[model samples]
Target: ALDQEKKQIEKEMESLNLAKFERLILEKQFRVLSYLIEDKKEKVNIVSCDELNNLLEVLEQKKQRRQDIKSHLDSLNKELACSNFDFEKAMLYRDLIDSEKKRLETVNLSIQQLEEKLAEFERN
Candidate 1:
């Protein structure tokens, strides 16, 4: 279910055509941010003042990317959640398929059991 939701969300994002660019930018920012965060966490003596400032700028960009991706993803999720198929009909179809699958499975199991019994009787 979670995977289905994720794919649905991704499909909607793809339809909007922003997901690709967002993904690309977000990936780049994430990689850069990881490096910058490591730099910031290093011993103060290891990083000069200019390097620290540069790290801060990258952090800011990472923050912005995080916000944008979250907002866009949230909006897409909401839109997908609220969008409707005919609930009654969809549910009916779902139930029908479920019932058919269960019936088929039962029939298959019965056939297997009968075949086993027949084989045993034939061997006797």
Candidate 2:
């Protein structure tokens, strides 16, 4: 009976140890994954779902900015064609148009960069 009791206890301890070792392994995997995430930045493959989501969010913001610029351009174009167009306002809008065009370029560049990053991530 005593021998039987010891064997049962030994079995329980082995099970506990196995559980503890598995927990440690999971912890290590999490730490390593975090490190890889930090190292990858916007480069490629190593990006996790969270980072990809963040990139998607940023892309949405850029797209919104592009839309805003386009709408403003349309408004300005209409104003320019109006018979009572104010020269001062036209000058201001022209300047704004130039800036908006530059902003559009930057937004496009950012989109291109993100697309490239996604492609690289996929290829990996």
Candidate 3:
């Protein structure tokens, strides 16, 4: 029954590996959800199904806001291009564009930081 014991051990190893993989996925999801939900005061270590659904809704809202900002920025760029002959309007558009660019850069940096944190968390 040595062969039987060997097969049992292999099966147990596979099960353990699967459990670890699932845990990693859950942890990553939790981190992302928590990071994106910026207004929440408490950290959620273990999320219920309903909470996950709420987090997903929040994610969609944030995505929509980002899209709106991008669309506004694009329109500003177009306006800037068309208003080159009007010096005052052109300068105003340029300033607006600069502010939007800075905002976008800040958002990008926050995302980068979150990813770095996730990687560090995984390493530990």
Best by TM-score: 2
**Candidate 3: C-alpha RMSD after superposition:** 20.5
Sort every candidate by lDDT, greatest first.
2, 3, 1
Pairs that clash in candidate 1: none
- Candidate 3: tens digits of C-alpha lDDT, residues 37-99: 542421242133324444445445445545655776797787667654467656656766776
**Candidate 3 C-alpha error for residue 94, in Å:** 0.5
Top candidate by lDDT: 2
* Residue-level lDDT tens digits of model 1 in 45-68: 224543444444444543454455
- How does model 1 fare in lDDT? 0.46
lDDT of 2 at 95: 65
- The TM-score values for the models, in the order shown, are 0.32, 0.53, 0.46
State the weakest 10-residue window (summed lDDT) of model 3.
Answer: 41-50
Q: Which of 1 and 2 is the better model by lDDT?
A: 2
lDDT of 2 by residue, 1-124 (tens): 6446646755665566465335434433443443344334433422455366666665665576568667756765675576364776567557655655776686678778877876766677
Q: Runs in model 1 with CA error above 4 Å?
A: 1-85
What candidate 2 gets wrong by more than 4 Å, as runs, is 1-50
